[model samples]
Target: MRSSVLALLFFACASQAGVIIGGTRFVFAENKKSISVTLKNRSAQTWLISSKISSGSAWPGNDGAVRPVIPFSATPPLFALHGNSENIIRLVGSGAELAQDRETLFMLSIAAIPSGKAPPGSVQMAVRSNLKLFYRPADLPGDPARAYQALGWQRTARGLTVENNTPYFVTLFKLSINGEAIDNPGVVAPFSKRQTPWCQASSRCQLSWQSLNDYGRVMPAVVTSVYTTSQGVSSRVITSASPSR
Candidate 1:
């Protein structure tokens, strides 16, 4: 006889499995030896908790055969989390060499499997949560909080081009062009550029955007004007900042 299992995957922020992760995103500073994250089990039943760290590119649905070697480790990788109880998971670095000038990204995965036995031929549900993990090296130039201010924007024939010259990753959201919302305005990696196909041929266009801070809090909205110059497209900030709603 063959058995079947049903798995439900969720990001840390949207997890409904009674297991609460303390933070949406975790930062591991190079100067620190390790960092601890709190996990609370609110259900009335026990669960088998498993945690691991993986490269940022790895997704929960990917096969394990092609998984990259993880440079960090989560202590107490496997444990029985009692109901209405809390546990701490420590993320420790393996002293592996990473980028010294820029921040490296990783993913922390937590899975909670029901410990009780289910009825015969019944489906079992397992909940897995993934959270972003950023490793910031010490003595990095510029302030991370203000890094988004340095982002460069240009209006192209196809769409908009965003440039990030800073060494910190910028997670952008709530993007709009000329009062129209743009779908899936994703993140811009450190020292990189990304283009989104959304702009039309306009002499000047208003671009509004918001970014997330290190603690996952939404930063203030910034509105800028993109002008089609004689040489090329350029941008100027009309409003540097505004209160975040």
Candidate 2:
């Protein structure tokens, strides 16, 4: 069963017209497991999704050389979606079925919501990465194609890994957190335009908060992809003020 609950109030507006997309700027790699993205079918007709998670081109870096696309493998990253049931994971393009491209590692995030009228300024989250399809129009059971347009949102996040200034240890790391299930398959933290704060142990000890109080993900979710060449030494530590703050 699916819940009619709204995750985040974010959507993309199409004043004159434009392709709809979803995902997040932030992705938390808890122990480095997986990542996900969501989409809505907004086409007057049903559409299929195709994908290509490539190790795109590279440019100049600090050392002056080409670098990896996302600090992680662009080939077949894990993909899954939530369902009516909490933690309910569904692979892309299955049940309720949506079409997708061949050489793509489809995400498991399912298509649950299909708005008949996505206003001109429907708000969404992700603003980085290339566009990649995640859903089709047919995903919606009986929703007429009349007042609707099949929206196939493709989330392609951009990333780069820093060596942590360690000539060794690879200095590799990855970070991504799930967004509250509206689209993202990792975090479920909602967004707020207001400021909210919190702390524990002691007011000056340790705490975490979004601009609304905890740097919440629709607070602008962002992800960091990292990797170590592993061609040199291992285990590196960084605790310098070289940049001088």
Candidate 3:
């Protein structure tokens, strides 16, 4: 078994910032879908009752003023500009379509906020504007008719197993480690019956990769691709690893 050696840093670490700014989707097509901003109150205190994103993009009226949208709706939200730090306020919204192609640009904004009875200084402000891309359904097609398991890990060697949960042809089977492309060790047009992941070796240690299940269309392979200086190695895809029996 692998052991951990580094210091454990939980979410509650004292030095962690009280507020954080982020979004669900970073990339999307224009006029596609709205995005959602995640506001995390890492501080022990509850968010101020009056809190709402104070600063955000001014929506464009026919005249050209930025209108702000709060309690942003939808996921993968967009913002006007790129800002930094939890202390910086961020807003999201749709911008007037580009004069060139009529495509809208996502906008974000940031500003300082009043803490109210919490601290002498104003707290950080966070908000969302809108999604540049309108919206789109998940690309992964509804759940596969059949289910397959994928196994992956950080460091260490392991065996693989394949279970034909459904019927389909899994094509162009390949393997990779630490981002370096490698040829499949065992030569075979069709993966063996088990379809389990196989791997060993390391930039500094041996790793493993294997195909677990063939359900419908997804390649659905698992890889163990994480390592630690202290623990030696740990597999991220432990569940993908089949039982020793």
Q: Pick the candidate with the highest TM-score.
A: 1
* Candidate 3 lDDT over residue span 144-222, tens digit each: 2122232222343453333332222122234555555556333111112433244444434233333322221234444
State the TM-score for model 3. Answer: 0.24
Residue-wise C-alpha lDDT for candidate 2, range 1-245, written one tens digit per residue: 11112214332322112223354222222223333444443434222233333221211111222222232222223222122212212222223221221111112222223334443544323222342211222222322111011111111122211221111111011212122221121111111011112111111211111111111122211232112224522222221111101
Model 3 C-alpha lDDT versus the unseen true structure: 0.31
lDDT of each: 0.76, 0.22, 0.31
* Runs with alpha carbons beyond 4 Å of true place in candidate 2: 1-19, 24-30, 56-245
Superposition TM-score, candidate 2 onto the true structure: 0.23
Off by over 4 Å in 1: 1-14, 58-69, 117-124, 200-205, 229-232, 243-245
In model 2, how many backbone clashes occur? 52
Give the Å shift of residue 244 in candidate 2. Answer: 18
The number of clashing residue pairs in each candidate reads 0, 52, 60
Candidate scoring better on lDDT of 2 and 3: 3
- 1 or 2, greater by lDDT: 1
TM-score of each: 0.79, 0.23, 0.24
Error of 1 at 233 (Å): 3.5
Positional deviation of 202 in candidate 1, in angstroms? 6.0
